[model samples]
Each structure stands twice: as structure tokens, then as C-alpha cells.
Target: MGLGVERFTTQLPEHLHCFVCLDVSYPPVIVCALEHQMCESCATELRKSSSKGKCPMCAQTMLDPVRTSGVLKRAIEDYEVTCRYTGCKWVGCLLDEPTHAKSCDFREIPCALCKTPYQHSRSVQHMLVCPEEVVLCPQGGKRCARKKRCELEKHLSDFCGQWQCRVVQGCDTRTSLANLPAHEKTCADAAARIAKLEEALSGRNETLATILTELRAKLDSLDPTRHASPPRFDWPAGQPAERTVSTCTLVKQLLTRATKRRHRRATLAATALLAKPLPSPHVAVLQESAPASPPAPALA
Candidate 1:
């Protein structure tokens, strides 16, 4: 009395498959005048294969393919498809299949140069600095290998034996690449000479500093009135003669004091020089080489 009817089905419609490729049609699906749909990629291949550009199913003349309708596009998107890649069991909506394929770890991609298979996304980056890829040494072929591109620079800088010293002014010593630091530390002759020169310079500096201090002190003592301004006198006209005479006497006293201070300074300097023992033979030679003072000119 009753025939069983299956209510629900998740199967994709046959019209949604490309007629030429016999695979699920992806957007933008091309439609013939009879409304027969084909995937865009298959439609292009079919056109290229056929000089007359005929539709595979209807044998009708093919024209430029138009964009698929939104309702059909949505229906295709809702349909689920299993991953085409072998060993991958992922199942998702038709719209997201391409994205999943792009990021899928199990997808195989061939290397650009070596043609070795690798994971899909990492293939391009692996090619860039690949160890198997040959590259020349950066140091103009100084006993360096045409090693891997990633290791070429490191080989020249850190492992090449022909590298020269980096020190600019001193020590032209050239050594092996790894021995540069060790050679710089024990570079004997130049280092010893530099040390001796530095010691001599320090001694000269000390002697100069002592002489400068003595000279400064002597100058200070000699010119007591150096910073003192001359006395300003506002003498009114018709002043007493005795007041004028007193002013002149005061000025004479100041000049006499300045002259005495100068003589005293010269005496003290000479005495100090005589009292100091010469610390080095160089000082005795300097004293002997100094010029004699000329006799004072006769007063006219």
C-alpha cells in the first residue's frame, strides 16, 4: 500500500557540475542559451580546444561567458565538498574550498629551482634562503666556497683565513679571520713603543704644569695694583695749594709701592729657581742653551 520516499538529501545537483570537466562548477559559471552551466576554467579550456568555440554539451556556438546569478552562486556556496588533495580529509563549503587548499599543510608544492615538494605556503620562502642554492662569496673569492646563499657572508667574515687587520692607524698585521682578536692583543713591538711614548708625554705634562703654577704665582705677587683702578680725584678749582701738593705726594707714594713690589717679585723668583734641585739632565741642558741678557743701553 505504501512506497517509501526519502525526505532529505545533501547531494549536489548534476547541473552544478561542469559538463566538459565533469567536476563541481565554481564561479563565475558560464551558461549556454539552453541554460547549461559549466565552470569558467573549463569553459575557457573548451573554447581554446575548439576552433569554432562550441559548447561541450549542446554543440552550440560559444560566446563570452557572463557572471553567474547570485541565487545560483549562494546555492553553490552552501554545497559541501571534500578536499581534492590526497591524504587530506577536510570537508567545507564550496566557497571556502580554495582558501582551505591554500593554507592546508598536507598540500604539495614543487620548489622553483630544485623541484622538491614542500608544504604549500612555505615553498616560496624556502626557496629564498635555501641551503642547497649556490651563491658566490661576498669577499671577491678569497679562498671562500661558492656555498649556500645563506652561509656565504658568514663564511667570508668569520671563517676565511685571508682577512686583513681592521686597525687603521697602527699595526698593519694581517692574520686569519678567527685570530684577529688574539693578534691585536699581543702585537708586541708597536704596543711597547706606544706605551713608552705615552709615559714620556705624561712626564712632560707634569713638568709644564709645575712651571705654569710658579709663573702664575709670580705674576700675582708682582702686580698688586693689577686689578686696582687708578685713584679718581675730583679737585675743585680755586682749591688750596697745600691740598694740590698733598695729592701729588699721595700719587708718588703709590708709584713707589708698585716699583718696590716688582723688585721683590724678581728677587723671589730668582731665589726660588736657585733653591730647586734639577730633577732631570734635560733641565741642565735647557739652562746651558738659554741666551745671555744684553747690556742695558746707556742713558742719553
Candidate 2:
């Protein structure tokens, strides 16, 4: 009763309790010269009842005014206290017990919004479903209006659908900004998807490079004497130095091969270019292509 705890008596040891009232001796524990300890209320009442300052325990003439026991007060303050709230599982010192009680999640507190008292631990559940509660969109920024928590999902889809991600370099982060604990899956994880696409394109690039190297080598072998003389094409009447049919055939073959590979290359390029994340409706992705290496000085 002294501490105003619901189950205060259940945790205190018998030795710490007042001898008269059998309650935990809180601060201001009055002590007689013989060191008999009782609550301040009990000491005051006993003094009023007796003609002389009489010891309650031994029936002896006691000191005129019993002094407050500083030693006992300090000792009791260090005592371990278990929270009085059932199922709270908060164990702390007697000094911190009062403070913890005020902020304990198990304790019922009035909501600032609805003004209805509910257990603070279940605040998320209550806030989401409480008819009186109103919440703002988390991703909608300043544009979205406050809506009932129950109807927030529809509002997010309809109202916050156009909310663009302001992620630095867009897809550079390792995790999605929207993917938080108990948060809705709103935006795509751009980083992870881009990583996968880069992986797939990596092997394809090596293959394309090998093909280019082989073609270049073949072209170099065909024009073995390219350095000696500049090969001349079939010109109008009185043109000098006639070129071979083999050179023309080689050029045709190379063009045919390039045309065939161009479609394949374009298909792969298109696939990479259209990297659409499943969750995102509109994408503002950008990529810079490296300048194409000058085709190995073509020999005509």
C-alpha cells in the first residue's frame, strides 16, 4: 500500500516489512533507539495513543521523537523489485520500479489520438484497427491527406502510387528503402534486380568479345599484304589496279556474319535495356554505353 503497487506485498521479504502494519517499509521508516522499525504512519498513531513515548514492541519508555532511519532507507532502495504488472517480466531495483511502472507497456495508457486507454504493447494493433484513429501515408510525403488506418492500404495504392523513389543513384543501395519490419512491400528492390541483370550480361559480354576477336583475326589473315599496297575497288573507264574476287567475297561474308550477329546482339541489348522491376509501375532508369572500339582498321 505504501508503494501503491498492485501486488506490492507478494515480492517483499518479511524482514523488510513494517512490524506493526506488515507492509514494506518505504522511505521515512521511523526507528526507536532500540532500532525497532515501523512505517511513519504507524509511529505517529502509536505516539498519539500512548501517554508517554512508548515502544510498541517491548513496552519500554521510548525516545521522545523517533528518528527516520537513513541507513534502512538506502538499503531498501537497493532492493531488487519485480514489476507488479502481471506478465510484464520487468525486474529492476526498488528505486527504478516507480519510473518503470509509469512507462510499462503492459500498463493501460490513454492514447493521445483516440483518448481510449489500452495496453501500450498492443498499440500497433489498436492504432491500425481503431475506428477513431487517423494516420498519414508513410511514403506519400506531404501530398497525401490523413486517412483512417484501416483504409490506408487502398489510399497508398491509389494516392501514393506515383510517389517516386529518391534513392541515391537509384539502384545502388544494397537493400530496398521501403522494405522495413512490418512495412508494406511498396517499391521494388532495384539494387538486387540490377545485380542479377549485370551477372547475366557479364558472361554474354565475354562471349561476344571472343567472337569479335576471332572475326578480326580471320580478316587480318585474308589481307596478309594489306600494308604493302592499298587495294583498289572496280572504278569507271581507265581505273588502275584491279582488286581480287576473294576480297569482295570476304567482305560479303563479313557483312553477312555481322548482320546475323547484329540481331542477336540487339535482342540481348533490348533485354538489358528493358529491365523492369516487378513492383515498379514506371521506371526512370538510365545507362551510358561505352564507346564502341573502332572496328579493327578494315582492309578493303
Candidate 3:
């Protein structure tokens, strides 16, 4: 009710009590005498209710009906008092009561961002997910400056273009989309592209190596000298052999020359296809020359 009279170390004078409410009168109104004062709230109510133009305590005619006593208000505020909120142990001069009420832990206050009421003690917890609170864009926050916490997911996928690019070959750099014109020049994505290119080239080389091996095998199979040995015939008992081994030998010689020419051409084509140097370490280098074919068997 009135600033607690019990809180003060020394008892206040009897004149300080309002004649109407019988409580310690704050903002005491001086109606007639200094000894007969009423609380401003009581005086104003009585003025409107009853037109008795007389001071209730001393039966004296009311003169100007003045309602405020600055001296009494100051006297009341000078005394120390404890906080009114239940369980709050804070004690201070009455003048500071309004300031302390705003920050008391047990009191409820509205969030500045969302305007939702919550306990002052929970301010830190409330701010963590407050929809209106501004926060970094979470997906590489360094790029985009700010976003509302409620919009974090939308900002990640739709709004913010900057992202943590894929790391490649132990490079831990990140590049932004804002500087996309120079994207290839930046080492971050450049390293990633290089890694992808190497993978593709490695597979191509493996395929090329297989093709070259197949071509080499086909060329060796076509060697005429490999079939140069003459087949033995079942001779008639009385007749001389119509065809001599020398005749078969001459035919084989012509075939060997023609086969050699084709082998040389196939080898040259393979070499041309593999002319460029392979950069990937995973693929073995293709040599310029194939291993020499075993010397052509002597033509019969």
C-alpha cells in the first residue's frame, strides 16, 4: 500500500498518516492545516464524491484545495525499502524502486525483438530461437551478412548462394558465388576441377591401354612367318611328290613381306592415338616402341 513504514529504521511522525485512509500518506495534500493532511488519491476521490468544503480531520473550511506536498513525497522516497515482488531480496532507497523493477530476475519482461513476454531470467534462452533475432547465414556465414533465425533454412537453400565447396586433395578452401566471374582462377574450386579432370583422364588412359594391347595381339597373330612350316603330305608309294617344299617356301616369303607392312601400319596408328603425354600418375606411361617381336622364323 503506502511505502512500507515498517521498513524505515526510525518511526515517522504521526502527521505523516493520511486522515482519510489512515495509511502513511505519500504525496500528502495540504487542505487546511499542516497537521491535517490527506493522501492525494484520497483527497481527489473525496473531492469528487462529497462537496463538503471542509478538512475532514479538523473541521476547518477548505481553502484552495491544494493536492500535492513535494516535501512529503521527497521524505517518503528518501527512506530505504525492500523490493515488493515475492522472493526478491533486493533492498534500496524508494527512489530506485522503478529502476530495479525493470531488471528483476523474477519479473516478466517482453523480448525486444519478438515482443513476447518471458521471465527476465530466461532472456538468454529466449533469444536463442527468437524468430526476429538476426543471425549469421549458417551456411558459410562469412558470405551473407545477416538473416532472421526463423528463416535460416530458407536462407541456406534459396537466399544465400555461398556454400562450403567440396574439399579436394586436402585443400580446405571455400569460395563464394559473388566472385563467380573469377571462380576458375580461385584455387579452391580450381583444385576440385583439377581432381575431377584427373579422374576422367585416368579412366581414358586405362581404356586406351587396353585398346593398344588388343591391337598388338591382333598384329602378332597375323604374322605370316608363324605359319611358314610346310605341312607333311601322305606320299603315294610309286609317285614322285608333285609339289616340292621349295614351292611352298616361295609363297610364304611373299606373305611375310605383306604382313610386315600391315604390322608397321597398325603400330604407327596406335602410337599416333597415344601421342599426347598422360598427366595422371595412376596410369602407367605408354612407351613409344612396342617390345621387339621375336625374330621372324627362317622361311623354309
Candidate 4:
């Protein structure tokens, strides 16, 4: 036909050996020991026996690269891979290698249902329907559907629990250290006592007025003239008893009796004036009268 197809063939076809059995035509590319290679699973198994990381076939350090053909590498890039495990069922592109490794078919995640560690592919499906994955009501001693824990606590405290039974009765002020126990015992008692005292003081105002009136009356009842005794006359001394004393004594006695009568009348008048509640003018009169003492008796 056109010159035989074989004429166009080059070494590219010849080097296409399965890196594994070297039996197949195509080999997948993989990385191992910092080198590019094919058949990674076989290389990994081979690593167990040799701590040196030597290649199984060549006994060379597995650090040696077994580069896959550029053409095969490009072909693998176009294909998608899926895990073969039954429930696992993760599927993604070969080009997404790093991403797949991070969240991959073989990766592990804890199960929501059983809490058992299972493959990520299966765990994702299990979590969707898992009973344990359901967030519970935190207020009632379980995780709540409400997003905020604080809100849940408020709801339970206000609406759900026996909060009414826990109602606080009195004001909640912190008493000073010196007054705490005394405040507790007599807080209400002290308030009541203060109120009673205030009421007594306010209501007894008329009684107080009456008492003041009585005190003023008693003070007014005092006799102004009673402040001093009646003046007394002295009998004359060193005189002859018969010649000087007889007529003088008789006259002195009469004058004394007359003076006593005048004094009694003055006292009666002052007592009556004071009893009538004299104003400031009577006080001046009383003071003026008080200074007049009787003249000293003539020597007999």
C-alpha cells in the first residue's frame, strides 16, 4: 500500500514492555524512591524485604528510577480510575492524582454510624445516613439542632426546665462583710421597723403639739411675786426696854401686819396676772417690783 507500515515504525513501539511481567504491551507510570517507574504496587511489595530499598530484579537500590514511556504517561493522564472495593466506590480522574491521594479511594475516615475506621469512600456514604451523625439537642443533654450553644442553654433554662421552682425571692445585693449576717436576719424586719418609726413620728405631731401647750400652761401658772419673801423689819436694839420699846413695838407690829397684808395682796394680784398668761410687758413689771426691799427698821 503506501510503503509498508513497518517502514515507519521506530524504537517507541519496541520499548513498550509491561514494566511488571515485561509481558504486556502497556505499563502504568508510578513514583518510587524519588524515581519515576511503572508497576508501583510490585515495587512497594518488593520494598519489604530490602531495607536498603534495592530493586527486586536488579538488586539495585530502589532509589534508581524506572521511568515509564512518555507516551504511556500521557495515556494514563487521560484515563479515570475507580476503587474496586464494593461499598467504597470512589471514582476520580488519574490526572487528579494529588487530590485523590489527599481524599482518596484507599484513605481512611472514622465512621459516623459505628465509630469504626473505614475507607473514606465508604465513610462518606455512611455518614450521609448515619444515626450518630445527626446533631442532637444539646440543651436536653444532647447536641442541639440550634447552631449556637449559648442560645440552646437559654432556651432550656427559660422554657424546658423547672426554672419557676428556682425563683429567687428577695433582692440580691452583696452586704458588706461587717453587715452580712445581720442583714440576712433582719433585712425585712429592719425595713418594717423603720417604716413604723417614721409613721409614729409623723402621726404623733398633734400629740406633740398638745404636750407643748401643757408645758407652756404650767410655766405660766408660776407666781411671779412668789420669787421673794415678804420684807421683815428689824427691832431697834440697845434701847431702854420700858421707855423706848413699848409704843415703838406696838407701832412696829401694826406696821408689820399692814405691810404683810399689802404683800399678800400684791402676791395675789401677780399670781392672777401670771395665771392669765401675761405677755412680755408683765415680765418687765415683775422685774421692777422685785428690787423694792423694805427700809431698815429705825433703831428702837
Cα lDDT computed for each candidate against the true fold: 0.69, 0.67, 0.72, 0.53
Q: In model 1, which regions exceed 4 Å deviation?
A: 1-108, 114-128, 135-146, 150-159, 162-174, 178-182, 188-196, 230-300
Cα lDDT for residue 151, model 3?
Answer: 85
TM-scores for all candidates: the values are 0.34, 0.31, 0.34, 0.23
Worst 10 residues of 3 by lDDT: 281-290
* Highest lDDT against the true fold, candidate: 3
Off by over 4 Å in 2: 2-14, 31-34, 40-55, 58-67, 111-117, 124-300
By summed lDDT, the worst window of 10 consecutive residues in model 2 runs over 173-182
Cand. 4 Cα-lDDT = 0.53
Residue range 17-117, candidate 1, lDDT tens digits: 56666555666465467666777776677677745567767777776654565666777777666765666778876678789888787688877666777
Q: For model 3, how does the per-residue alpha-carbon lDDT over 229-285 read when each residue is reduced to its tens digit? A: 788755433534546546666567658877999999999999997997667654434
TM-score preference between candidates 2 and 3, better one: 3
Per-residue lDDT over 1-300 for candidate 4, one digit per residue giving the tens place of the 0 to 100 score: 111112111223333334554422234433454444545445555556445566544555665454555776565445455533334355554455446566566666677455667677566666655545543344343422432333444455444432221122454544333454455566667667878999999879979999999987787678566457788655445545545568867688768878999999999999998889556887898997897788999999
List clashing residue pairs in candidate 1: none
Tell me the tens digit of each residue's lDDT in model 2 across 1-300. 244334442466666677777777765455566678777777777777744667778777665677778877776778677786666998877788889999897888888877888787888877876766777767664557787776777766555543444442453222223333112233345455777899999989999999999998999889968656776643434433445435676667668778989999999998987885464433323223446678898788
RMSD to truth, every model? 23.6, 31.3, 27.1, 29.7
Candidate 4's C-alpha runs over 4 A off are: 1-37, 50-61, 64-71, 80-93, 96-109, 117-300
